[model samples]
Target: MSGAKSVSPENRTVIGLTFGNSNSSIAYTVDDKAEVIANEDGDRQIPTILSYVDGDEYYGQQAKAFLIRNPNNTVAYFRDFLGKDFEHIDPTHNHASAHPKDVDGAVSFTIKDKAEEDAEPSTVSVSEVATRYLRRLVGSASDYLGKKVTSAVITVPTNFNDKQKAALLAAANAADLEVLQLISEPVAAALAYDARPEAQVEDKIVVVAELGGTRSDVAVIASRQGMYTVLATAHDYEFNGVALDKILMDHFAKEFLKRNPSAKDPRENARGLAKLKFEAEATKRALSIGANASFSVESLSDGIDFASTINRLRYETLSRTVFEGINRLVESVIKKAGLDVLDVDEVILSGGTAHTPRIASNFSNIFPQTTRILAPSTNPYAINPSELGARGAALQASLIQDYEADDIDQSTHAAVTTVAHISNAIGVVSLNAAGEEIFVPVVPAETAVPAKRTVHVAAPKDGGDVLVKFVEGNTHIKVTKPEPKPKEDKTAKVEDAADSDEESDFSDDDEEEEEKREKVWKIGNTLAEAAIRNVKKGGKVEVTVQVNADLSVILTTREVGAQGGVRGQLNA
Candidate 1:
C-alpha cells in the first residue's frame, strides 16, 4: 500500500480487463452487475499505445496523437511481439515504430531521441512498453472507480503460451495490480453472452469469431447450462482491421498521386502516411455502416491535400483476400474441433470488424441459414464490438471475487464450469529417411486440455538417442526465392543495327547461372525433449505428451515395454 497500490482491507476494488493488439478496455462490477468504466476520453475502449516526448510520457489518445508527429518514439502494436524473440518476428509485419533490435535474445525497440527528435535513440524492452501502457490504464481505472484498483482479471488469446502469460503478468505487476485470472478471449466472450438475460439455457455448439484490429480468432465453444467451454480455436494475424487499413491506405495514396502527378510519393512521408492511416481507419468504420465512404486529409503531404471516395463494392473487392482468410480460420477451427458447420447451433460474431456488413455476409454465406448469426452485444454499457472480451472478463472478475469470498450466489453468475481444452495442436517433429521434417501431432489442436496422448515412433538403427520434442501449436514454414532475371540479347540488337547476318563472338551462355536455394526456417520453441536407449531397430519408443488447461506441457519417453520413463515439465 506504500510503494505500489494494493487492495485495501476496507475497500476491495477489482477490475476486468481485455488487452488487445491495438486497443484495450476495463470494466468493474457495481451492485453485482458488470459495466464498462469510461476513461478520460469518455470511451470504454482506448488505444493501447504509449509515447515519450522530451522525457515526458503520454498514453491513450495523447500517445496516439503523438504517433503522426513522432512515429519513432510512439509504440503501438507492441502486443504482437510480446513473449517473442527477434528471430520469431516476420520482417514483413514491420511498422512505423523503430525496428525491434535483439537484446540478449529478447525483443526490444530503439526509441528515437524524444528530447531532440534527431538525437540518438534509447532502447526499451517490449514488456517495458507494455508495462508503461498498463500503468496508464490502471491510473485511468483508479480515477474512474474513485478508488485504487488493485486486482484484475485479464483476457488473453487461448493459444498464448506460458512465456506470453508471464510477460503479461509482469506488466500487471509493474502497474501495481495483482492479476487474479487470465481468461481466454473466446471464453470471456461466451461468458458475457451466457450472462445475458435473454440468453437461452440450452446445450449447443457455438462458434465465436472475433475479428479484432490486428488479428482474427475463431473458437468453438460447447455451451451447456449457462457454462462455457472452449473446444477448438484458430487465428489469422493477416486477416484483420489492420489489413483493411492497408488496403484503404494504399487506395488513397494512389488516388492522391493520380490527382497531383508532380507530388512526391506519400509513402516516403512518415507524418503524411501516418495521417493517411488514421483517416483510413475512420473511413473503414464509416464504410461499415454505409455503402460508401470518403477519405480526406488536409495538407496531407507538403501542402498538398488528398481525398478519395471508396464504395462498398470497391471496399469488398479490396478486402476479398482478408475475408477469405477469416473464412478459412473459422472453417479450420470448426474442423479442428471435429465438427461440421451443420453441427454448429450458433455463430457469434464479435470484435470491431464484426460490424462490417460484408464480413457478416461472408459468415452467412459460409454457414447454414438455420445456424443463426448472433450480432454484436446490445448491452446498456455501450461496449463496442471490440470490448466484449473485457466486459466478460470483468464479469468473471466478480465471479472470482465471490468464489473467493465463499459466497456462491446465483446473482453473481457463479456456475460449475471449466475450460476443458486448449485451442491449438501440440506435437513433436520427426524426420523420415529423406530427412524431411514432419510434424507428428500427439495432442491435436482443439483437444481437451488436461489431455495426454502416446505415440509410437520407430527407434533409430542401433541404440540411437530417442528424441521427443514438443511444440505448442500448429507450425508451418514457407520459403520463397526470387525468380532469375532473363539474359539480355545485346548482340542480337547490334546485329539488327548492322542490317546483316553477322553475329558477335560473345556466347549466349556467358552469363553465369547462380544457383538459388529456397531457405525455410522452422518457427517453434522446443518445449520438451527426451533421451531413449536400448531399443532394437524394429522396436518403437512410447512418447507421451500432455498439456493442461494452464498450458503446462509434460513429455515422457521410454523404450516400448519399459518399466519407467523420463519426464519433464518443459518450463524452459
Candidate 2:
C-alpha cells in the first residue's frame, strides 16, 4: 500500500492559492512538475496590504512605503474586514478607529479627510480590496510564466464556515480567477507531506500546528492506504504570532512611556510604534537561535532615544501564556481524536511562528517520544513558511487531477467506520400516553453518514398529534412532574365483620381470590405505514438495516413490485 503514484501529463495547468491573515501565497505545477516564481518585486510573498490614492487608483507595497508621508490617503489590511459584520468588530482587536459599514454583506470603509471635510471622501468595499490583492498575485504569476492563468485551488482555515468561504470564493471570482477548489489549511499540509518521496504509507497520525499572524489551528490527520482523512480539528482565532510580538512590544512600550511621559499621543506615535513592532518581531526570531538580542528605538519625542535588550529566557517567559494555550489545544485535540501521545507519528509545523526555536522546543516537550517536528524546505523564490501552504495546495491539485483521470471506482474500497459497535443506538424522542417523554433509538452516532434506521412507536389512542423529534447526539430525556392523584371515596369502603374468626378468615381468603386485573387491548392502527406514506419523493425509506465493519448503518427500502428494489448505502 505505498502512497506513491505516478501523475499523468495533462493539458490544463493547476495552480494553488494559500491566503492567510497577514500574507498570501500562490504556487503552480507545469506538466505535473512543480514550478516556482517570484513577484515583480523579486519576492515570492507580496505584502497583503492595499493602498488607495486619489483619482481612482490603488496600490500595494509601493504605495505602503509612502504611508508615513501620506497617511490620509492610505488604507492597509482591509482584508481583515472582508465578510465581517458591522457589530462584530471589537475596538481592542481593530487597529482602525473608524469602523466600516456593511454594504451587501461586505464591509465598506471610507477614507476620510484629515481636516474638516468640505470635500467628499471615498468609500471602498472589502471585497474590492481583497480582489485587488488577489488579482495582483494572479497577474504577477501569469506574467512570470508567460501564460494566461485561469483556475486556482485556494486554501482557507478549517474553522471558516460556509458564509466566509462563499465570500472568499466571490472575491476570487471577481478577480477573474476560476477557482478549482477551497481546501482546509491543515489538509493541504497533509497533502504536501504525503507527496514526499520518502513518505511512508501507513495509518500514521500527524498534527499540523499552524501559528500564524492572527490565529492558530491544530488538526490531526490519519493516512490510510492512499487516502488521507481529518480525524479532529481545533483552533483559536485570537492566538497567533502577532499577539506574541505584541506581548514583547507592550513590555517595551510601558518602559518607554514611563521615561517619556509627555509623549502621549497615539496617532503621532503610530509610525514609530509600527517600526518598534517590526523590531520586536525580528528580535523574537533572532532569540530563537541565539541567547540574546538588542533592539533600539531612535529619536522619540524631544529627541530622546530608547534601547532594550532581551534574553531567550525573558522572551520565553513573556510568551509563556501563548505556549500554554497552544499546548492545551494540542492535548485537547489528541484526546478528542481518541488517541494518545504514542499514536501520533509526526507533528508538522507551519506558519510564521513555527519558525521560532522556542515554540518548536515547547512542542517537543509536550509530545517528545512520537513527535518529529520538521521545518518546511525552502523554495528558491518563496519564503519557506508562506510557500509551504501553497506548495501543499499545488500537490493536492495534482493528486485530484490524477484521481479524476483514473476514474477509480470508489465502491470497490471498504467503507471506514468511526463507531465500533452500537451499544446504544440513536432514536427520536416522543411523549408516551401518560405524557412522559422517552427516547426511542433509531440510528446511532458513529453510524455512517446518509444512514437511515427506524424504531416502531405506538400511535396515540385518541388520535392526537404525535410529533417525532429527531435529534442528533446522545442527550438524556427530561422527566415531567407527575400529576397529583385524587383522593379515594371513604363512604364506599366495606367494613370487615368482627364476628367469628372462621368467617373473618374466609373473607380474607375471598379478597385474595378476587380476579387479577389484566390490561385491556386498545384499538389503534400502527403509525409505521403512515411514516412510510409520508416519505417524500427521493427520500430514503427505512426497511432493512445493515451494519458495516466500521459500525456504520445502511438502510434499504422495501422491495418494489416486479422490478428489483434500489439499495442505498451509508456514507462515511
- State the C-alpha lDDT per candidate: 0.73, 0.59
Error of 1 at 35 (Å): 1.7
**Model 1, 1-572: lDDT tens per residue?**
12223343335578899888778898887765668888988867688888888878877878888878887788878786788888986534347755677999888888753577577878889888888888888899999978888788888887888788878878778878877667888878877777776667766778988889888889898764455667778888889898999999988888888888888878788888789888999999999878899888998887898777889888888888888788789989988977677667888778888877777666765665677777633223323566678878888887666343323222232232335555456667777788777667676544545567788876665646666666655533233444554549756645553542221111222222312222132425567677666666677888788776577778888888877889888541
- What range of 10 consecutive residues in model 2 has the weakest lDDT sum? 518-527
Candidate 2 deviant stretches above 4 angstroms: 1-12, 30-36, 54-81, 89-93, 96-99, 103-105, 112-119, 255-268, 376-383, 400-572
- Deviation (Å) of 545 in candidate 2: 19
User: Which candidate has the highest TM-score of all?
Assistant: 1
RMSD of each: 16.2, 19.7
lDDT of 2 by residue, 1-572 (tens): 11212223354455787777666777877655454457777765555765544444445456545454455565555555556675664324335222456666557767643344455775777787678778888887788878866667678887777667767878887887755566778867766666666667654567888878777898876654444556778888666787888888887777778877887532256666665666677788788568998877666434567888889878877887777777778889978876666557778777777776666665665564445765532212222555668877776666565343234214311222121333333444556667876555455323333343444555444333333443333433233433433437323332222332223211233332233322121222222221223333333323444556665545444322213333444443
* Candidate no. 1 TM-score: 0.68
Q: What TM-score does candidate 2 get on C-alpha atoms?
A: 0.64
